[model samples]
Target chain A: MTMAQMDRLLFGDNQFFGINHMSEEKARAQAMRFQKTDAIMEVLDVAYAEGIRTFMCTTHDRITEVADRVRADPVRYADFRFYPCMPYAHKYANAVTDHGMVGALRHFMPSDGVLSTALTGGRALATKEVDGIAKVLIDMEMKMFHGLQTPVIFVQNVFTDLLLGMGFTRALRIFHDHVVTKYGVEPAFITMNMPMLLEALEKEGIERPIICANINKIGFRMSGGFDAYLDALRSGRVRAVAMSVYASGAIPPDEAIHWISELPGVESIVFGASSAGNIRGTKALVDKYMGAPA
Target chain B: MDHKVRIGVVGLGKMGLSHFAMVNAHPQVETIACDGAGFMVDVLGRNLENTIYRDYDTMLDAERLDAVVIATPSRLHAPMTTAALERGLHVFCEKPFCLDWADSERLATLAADKARVAQVGYHYRYVGAFREMKRILDTGALGRITHVLAEAYGPVVLRPKRSTWRSQKSEGGGCLYDYAAHPVNLLNWFFGTPAQASGSVLTPIFSDGIDDQVTATLGWDEGPTAQLSVNWSDESHRKMTTRITMIGTNGRIFADRQECQVYLRAPDPALPGFEAGWTVKYTTELTEDPWFYLRGEEYSAQLADFSGAVAEGQGKAVENDFASAAQTDRTMAMMIENAETGQPVGAPPVTARPTPARKRGWFAWKA
Candidate 1:
């Protein structure tokens, strides 16, 4: 009922409490910036010192950069976690693809350009397009799910479908695809990509990886964006809810802070920042709301 | 008795009816003839004579009117006014002379060449509160304006919705074009043409590509800047009002229909504890008259001015030819286009939903 209770539920696990770092196309092009490895570790260290245990980046390219930079220094910063940009990779890829069952499979697959090219060009052993994309997705999950341990996916409006619309509990279990008919590997793992389905994994007494959601849905007012999430929380329909409170900047900071704190089952809210100024402002706001020591 | 002049009315929408009422009521003026969408002709036929013609050309040719009041569709406003001007008739066209800047400029140039009195329907200039603010600015009592925030909001009911004339992009019946005309015209009337405008446009409720909400930042000639918010998707049907706040070098003026307040921040003290902060120097509230004031005072004043202009050959009419109205129209058109395409279409880069420093404490806000 109180905000303190909700904050404890969300942040108590010491899961990745993070601030998003946005880099522009120009910034991305200039590979030579501040010592890439040391700079990233420095930011992770900053987040870690602020009671943050996990770190996440936005794009696949950014994630690869961080993953590559931290590859050698993995043990150097063992206390932190890395969240590769998988959600946007799926969404962006979907935006470009033609609509079909194969396209839907590709929507769940990873954003590795090499893997995507291999599937497209028939370089990889693909029985069919859907099977090919599903194989890539399965391989991706197996590859990263173990390394990252718990990966966070940012869903755009799809989270509502999983939670309130059709519960994905049964769908995750029934993975009778034509890919399995041809290949020996079963692709029941597609449910991991669905936010509500992944959340349900925890309730079924299966310890699934944690998924943080940053819902950047358009037409927040019309889609009943917040109302759906609020209804889910109030009805105890959702178990692991991460409140991306500031996704729509229309909601005032004070009101958002209050609502996030009072939501029944909200876990963590990932802070998005365009610049260091934004991070600083958010940090101040968080501190002000939590009654944390200034 | 003074020799009376004749004035013809065109496109009888709500504004057209106001013009008809004014023309009929005034003693010195004669309503020579008028034309609108057939509905207006029906509305006017009860009181006025059968001086109504369906087509503007027929009305112009048949009636020997000395001047004309144009309240036609935005796309036709420029052409209609231009035609009237060429016929040697003094013209008063509605706000947004053209849907775009180029068209507005062409109309402006045409009006300049003619020896006829021309003005756009920027009636807010004659509004009492605006008139008061103008006086305060002229007196230099408020000092130089540093920051200005002008807000205007109303439901879709203010402007009658038409299928062909309004809904069409060519006709210019979108949010920024229809509702925004008031604020844009007022902004131009209050301040000059904004050097550059950056803003976001949206159609949250309405299915049409027409915008329902818009927030814009206008950079002025001087260092002072302005933020304007105009919305048509307000909760209730009737939400008609324009609120303006101007922050000047010496003082700040906040004006709305309910109350108007002027704040003067006293100079801070050199010492810490004794430092003086901003203080409200003057506050005044106009008596709340019934809704009939719109029909009685505002409409009557505008009609009287138009009648006087027609009779005396010279009088202040609604500013249909003001350069600011044209720029405002251009800004609205550009904003609507920008909303349709994510790219900044001849407009400045604008964030769709920028983090507001202060909350829009409408019914949405709990506190």
Candidate 2:
């Protein structure tokens, strides 16, 4: 299998979207401050300068603008990478943005009457059709990341768990296959329930997939409970990418990074920092805990 | 109560399946599902361990359910909820409780009369930022909120091609019921039922008969008034973006899903956690993670609250009861009735005034 080197520390885009789990005031301030694309790029450039290449981002509209700039200045961002998380709605479901059940259907429907088609046959999407639908949406979402080294791509937690719940793990298999075959990179899944997702993915014969979830000392948002996560990490069931490591700012950076660094199988830690100092500080912490990224 | 709470989820659509998963995983709950669609029933039946039913009536007849979660379209909500409630089963119906105001009011009364745990899925109420906002507002921190703006925007209808149940006015009631009700319900939650609604407008950006953009004003004679703006055709937003901005005598408050932004003249001890200048509260601190989280903390929290309410009996008050949803339904009905966009008051009969001859005009100018 061909996969890019997973960094000890990766940059994320939650700060750009004004998502703060810990401090709403700080999140609002960052959101207002990063209203302009240049502001986001400035912070991203800081991470890039500090040797943080991978940017884990959702496919929000503003990020498309950011992608345009990144695409234009190739030489400047030669080693720049994107670890895109998609369906934009997945990250924002906490808000009343889901537009209801039919609204979600519209997001992935290839043509109209997905309902009609589903009614006609119990096997709504055959292998080819599933491939077609999955590939079309994936390609469309991946358009902004074109020519950039998107070494890793993620299926957002909402879609991941939805598919998992409906016993449609096949869709995830399809997502994994498409992202791997077409993109030539790792296809990852982000979910709240780590153990359940691991079991579901393994059931689909997707062995040791790259899974990202909330991994903090407090077990904040770790759905299967923190002990289950520790066991999964201990067993090396999957290649873990630690996110929300600070539990949305609840955990101190030192304590947060220390816990993740001591975990057995966390391949990467994706974090968002506003300042050069913050980025460098996190990088230094990662270096201190896990040693510098080779 | 010792025995597991038996729940049957009706309508095997996106939300239905999500609710099933969340409820199915609950340690104290046993979830079954029913759908009219053969494909969905078959797909789920073959995959999941729980029983799947093809017909709603058949499922109700066959299974001994303690409650039913109705996630059907807007029109079906009334009938499905009525059926479930008639069975003396607690009902958790999805939003836009009933498209018909009278029906919604009737159902609310019936649910109360029956003393059943009747709830509506206005999940935003479970969001921590909004919950914290409510806490602060109740404390009179943003004293005497004068005007408020409630907005919900999304990229649902960029360039409409085929019509789904969502695009049909009779079915989903377009953006008003499918999208706008969420923020409108929040408005009702923050302030009581509006005294009046007016100047409502529904613009069909792409769809023919249904609204793609909805705008209106809701006024409370005794309290703050709110301006509602909702559009599903906006591509700028990846998904729906609902925000509430309140301006008051003391300070101002603005919040969405992520964070609550507040500005106060001075720190009020009632909301003593913050200082004077400006304070923001994020959902992370505001929200407590539920036992099982599927989509969002709010989704899981909403379901958790429902099951908890069901388990606790009628003594436990439901935060989002049928009566609150009835108020939202009434507000929605008022907006629909007030929406007089069909007759755009065209500039009253442009009559051409007689013009004087060029020579006479020139002579008059010279004089």
Task: Show model 1 residue runs off by greater than 4 Å.
Answer: A1-294, B36-47, B157-164, B266-296, B315-320, B334-367
In angstroms, what RMSD does candidate 2 have relative to the true structure? 10.2
- The sequence of per-residue lDDT tens digits that candidate 1 reaches over residues B307-338 is 56656656334444545567777766655655
- lDDT of the candidates, in the order given: 0.51, 0.81
Q: Candidate 2: which stretches are off by over 4 Å?
A: A2-5, A13-49, A53-153, A170-187, A202-209, A273-277, A292-294, B38-45, B266-269, B274-277, B315-317, B340-367
TM-score of 2: 0.80
Judging by DockQ against the true structure, name the best candidate.
2
Model 1: per-residue lDDT, tens digit, A1-294?
111112211221111112111111222233333235455555555555555555544333335555555554667656555433323334333332223323444455665654455444523232244335444553453343344423333222322222222222332222223223433332222111233444455554434323333322221211223444455446654443343455335456666666565555545455543334445555556666644321
Worst 10-residue stretch by lDDT in candidate 2 chain A?
A: A93-102
Q: State the TM-score of candidate 2 restricted to chain B.
A: 0.91
